[model samples]
Target: MRKIFFSGAVLTASLLLGACSSTDSPAPAPSARASHNAADATFAQQMIPHHQQALEMAKMVPSRSSNPKVVDLASRIDRAQDPEIRQMQGWLSAWGVAATSHSMPGGHEMSGDHSMTGMMSDADMKSLDAAKGPEFDRAWLEMMIKHHQGAVEMAKTELAQGADAGAKALAQRIIDAQQAEIAEMQGLLKQG
Candidate 1:
């Protein structure tokens, strides 16, 4: 009787330990996947082309604007935005979404939803393209300031409503960096 009771107690203890260990282990494969939703997708899809336009605008500075400070700011925008575009592209690919599917009639245009805020209309872009020298510098600074403000608003929206951890992190980063750049641009505008 004593031997049987001892064995039974040991077995119970082992089973309890095993159960606790299993519960403490990591989650299964399916639950471990990152969470994302429509907002994250929309943010990525809209931002990619928006960033592309910024790059286009930045590229214009080297050839058209002679101001060293304006050129440096444009270069900074180009460098920062290019990597972010690729990052969002990766996120879209991971989500099985097309990055360019949301464009408007023209290959370069954004959909109607993204047309407001920081986005430059086709005519606005054409005007920027046509500008040169101090005209180009002033126009670029003004447009980019508005663009950065738009980006901050979009990022704030994402931080508030987005489901994905990764997307929210990127949104926060964008808000911080773009806000700083906006302040910098405003200072540059004051000088002109």
Candidate 2:
């Protein structure tokens, strides 16, 4: 009887220990385990090149425009967009998706399903590039206003459809920031 009791007690203790050990590590938090979906991937992929184009347009400003406001705006655009481009690229890398090229075979801009609105055509870009001084300033402001509007539109779509919290947050930030920039550009246009 003593032997049987001792064996039963040991078995009970062992089972309890096994159960406790199995639950030692709690399940991951829901937010920590949150996964991205296709909309998030698409937003990141499309926005990367869109930002690169903005940066390109910004780079042209210091060389072409003399207005202090235009120069400052261009610098701000460069600062804001370069990091965003990298962030989106990182998302694409993590998602295991290839970044889409902005160019096509005929040197035309690739819009990636034509969802990329406000994109400057090669001819439009050439026209902007050829303008100097006040002309460049006006053209840059107008183009950037349109570009920012497109960005806001894209961001709104992401916020509506994207699954990742981080991506959705970024989309909201983009909307707020670009909308402010759009207003500023419009003010600048009105001044000229």
Candidate 3:
């Protein structure tokens, strides 16, 4: 009787364990809290060229400016923005979107149908490209401050409307960093 009872108990335990086994279906992927959206795509598209222009301006510093502090600041800007440009580019690629936006009827890109905020006009860039020494330093600082301001504005818009977690975080970083640099530039301007 004891042997029979033990065998029955073992069989029951095995059946219970089999019933508790997990299903073969794969577990669902974790839901992303902040996913891509129109605003996120727009932000990346606008910011890429904006960062590129800043790099262009920074490159001009070494050859054109005499101020050590200004040159150093420009170097910092160039270093910081290069990676950010690549990052934005990666985002565009991952989303399967074009790096450049559709041109408006007037040859402009983006919704405004005019200029992107903080982008220097071709003429303005040309002027900076021509300047040298003190003039170059002054032009570089003033234009960059304006450029940074425009970036901050664009970033703020992203923060307000953007949906992607990564994009929104990047926007906030731009705002914080550029705003601090703007204040530093303003102080430098006051000194000279």
Best by TM-score: 1
lDDT for each residue of candidate 1 in 38-69, tens digit (9 for 90 to 100): 88888888778778888989999999997899
Candidate 2 Cα outliers beyond 4 Å, as residue runs: 1-34, 101-115
Predictions in order: lDDT: 0.84, 0.83, 0.87
Please identify which of the two predictions, 1 or 2, would achieve the higher lDDT against the true structure: 1
Model 3 lDDT at residue 17: 79
Query: Quick one: RMSD of model 3?
Result: 5.9
Q: Put down candidate 3 lDDT per residue, 132-173, tens digits, no spaces.
A: 999999999999999999999999999999888889999999
Candidate 3, overall lDDT? Answer: 0.87
Residue 74, model 1: Cα distance from true site in angstroms: 0.8
Can you give the lDDT of residue 67 in candidate 1?
Answer: 88
Model 1, stretches more than 4 Å misplaced? 1-34, 109-114
Candidate 2: tens digits of C-alpha lDDT, residues 1-192? 999999999999999888767856864456422468888888887787778788889999998998998899899989988988888877777667766645566433473345477777777788998999999999999999988888898999999999988889889989998999999999998999
Q: Candidate 2 lDDT (Cα, whole model)?
A: 0.83
The alpha-carbon lDDT assigned to residue 172 of candidate 3 equals 97
Summed over model 2, clashes come to 0
CA lDDT for candidate 1 = 0.84
TM-score between model 1 and native: 0.81
Each candidate's number of clashing pairs is 0, 0, 0
Q: RMSD to the native, candidate 1?
A: 4.1
Model 3, stretches more than 4 Å misplaced? 1-34, 103-114
Lowest lDDT sum, 10 consecutive residues, model 3, at: 105-114
